[model samples]
Target: MKNLICLTMLFAICQRTVGQQVELPKATFAMHTGFLFGVWGNYEARLGQRTVFLTEAGFSFQSMAVFTNEGKEDVITPVLLVGPRRYFKSKISKKKSGSARITRGFLGAHIKFKPNSFFLDSDGLYGYANHLGVFPNIGMKKTMGERFVMELALGVGYAHYFAKQEGWPENIDRPTVDLRIRFGFNL
Candidate 1:
């Protein structure tokens, strides 16, 4: 009787351990290659089944070659962003038919950086231009599998350029748009 009881207890413990092994979702990292827009790739990490941490770094290159205006040169500006995200899983159906699970939801608040660019006048003289600004962002994501995910986020914020710069219209301010994407493992 003593041996039977010990064996039964060990079996129960093993069963519990096996039950605790939950498979985690996959993660993703992606780049933005849109027209007139150049962005670096974004990285994300899944934590505790429903939350993610994100980081991104890159630069924007705006072409001014077509412009008949005095400032005709390409601009290279650095970009950096970081933030936390949360997701909600969708309910599953009771039907016996095999089907893939889908997850979708909103995410908010990551820090960002946008630097200013300088331009030259028609006479080929360089002049100081608008300064960069920092912005906070909010966004969303959609997943097709337990291991793969994709996200789209939009950020809005204010910016300030130097008032002393030449040709900078008075009372002008900085406002920017941030767009991002992610593709990688979910775990």
Candidate 2:
């Protein structure tokens, strides 16, 4: 009977010493810009302890300043991006305090598509083209508060153009770069 009582007391002591685990967000929704030159809406879902699946969609209306030097073409199209993000465990994330700031670095691979991209050239003439690209990126994310998150990322890759322009050659391809700033909320 005395041993049973001692075991019960030991169990109680162990339970008191161990704290509850912090719950991480399973999903997030964000508004971002700079991927394809316009505001984008993003949804990210946690796929594992350190991995997330991300997607963004938006309409872009801007000049082809990054892709072409062919007389400043005005491009209007819908942009879609899909990728997976992997987070690295950090010292800040190991803290148990409620107000602890979590900063994590991430790596990602993305594929972007812009279909039926309509453009107007310097002479005020219209044409059609499709753009597809693959970029590998790296970034850092910080938790501002209980719900707010901010991130900055950069990607380098190549973009291929599929259309016959007035004077340019068919199937033109160029090197591409993407820079993004994101603001998000946990859900």
Candidate 3:
């Protein structure tokens, strides 16, 4: 009986040691889709303990198919974005909290490429130009689950364009707005 008790105690101690040594699962990658009258998707990769890399792509379409005079036209725009994100770590609960939960703020830049805006024949008459610009954005993200997160961000930047007319369309340079909602999952 004494030997049995000694063996049982040893087993309990071993179990406790093993339990205490268990490590928390590390976050990997996440993918999310959001809708704000339009659909957008984002993919994020964990870089380190406090940083992540993000890539985003999306498009917006008009419902009415109308052309200039009397036809239907479909206008679609595709965008690609890349940036580095700094994350804040929370002590409360890693599984229930997102990296943004602990983030104080972040700064990043993105470039947008737009095509199908210019016509060869209208080059000197009514011409459309492609735009290129850089923007710095700030935002926060909240982790609701181990694999789910929500984020909101806003940014203001400038865009440069080539104009065909010298006086018309006075506003050749304009300020742009960047508003976004993102969802992510661990890969």
Candidate 4:
């Protein structure tokens, strides 16, 4: 009788443990490669089951090409991005494996700050330009294996320039576009 009771308790505990759902990752660290900022480190934290808050800080090696006329200049500028992203459930299914690839679509409204681009002007004057912008973006994040993740995003928005150089306009109606690809691992 004692052996039967022991076996039953062991079976019940094993069933309970095996039946629990897998928990989602709560934090991730990523790397970004894109148009404006060449390479950056990103951190994202889950705020809810389908929402995450992200922040990134990095250097832009191509800031001169985007902001100034010095296309061949090697300039490095500071870049910062902050935003909250909401993920939508995906409906895609797979027939071969009987399990779908985990892909989540996300929408985000991000604020970007690029400060202090030092460039030599056409008139031999050194100047600095600052950019502040808002971008509404749409993206898809795909999770692979246990910790690997990849994301792609596109955005179009407006940028306001603050310049301290002659012939450089402080235009607030400038249009900007962004495309980003990121690879990450859950931490």
User: Which is the leading candidate under TM-score?
Assistant: 2
lDDT of 1 by residue, 148-175 (tens): 5555666675555555454445634657
Candidate 1 vs candidate 4: which has greater TM-score?
4
Q: What is the lDDT of residue 169 in candidate 4?
A: 57
Flag regions of model 4 displaced more than 4 Å.
1-24, 34-37, 63-75, 91-101, 117-127, 164-169
How many backbone collisions does model 3 have? 6
Runs in model 1 lying further than 4 Å from the true structure: 1-28, 47-49, 61-76, 88-101, 115-136, 144-150, 162-173, 179-187
The lDDT values for all models are 0.52, 0.68, 0.49, 0.66
Task: Please provide TM-scores, in order, for all candidate models, with all chains considered together.
Answer: 0.49, 0.67, 0.53, 0.65
Order of the predicted models by TM-score, top scorer first? 2, 4, 3, 1
What's the lDDT for residue 134 in model 4?
82
Query: How well does candidate 1 match the true structure in TM-score terms?
Result: 0.49
| Model 4, global lDDT | 0.66
Per-residue alpha-carbon lDDT of candidate 2 for residues 9-97, written as tens digits (9 for 90 to 100) = 54344334432333346887776554445667888888876668999888666667424455556665688999887665433543445
Point out the higher-scoring one by lDDT: 3 or 4: 4
TM-score of 4: 0.65
Q: Which has the greatest lDDT?
A: 2
Look at candidate 2 and give me any clashing residue pairs.
none
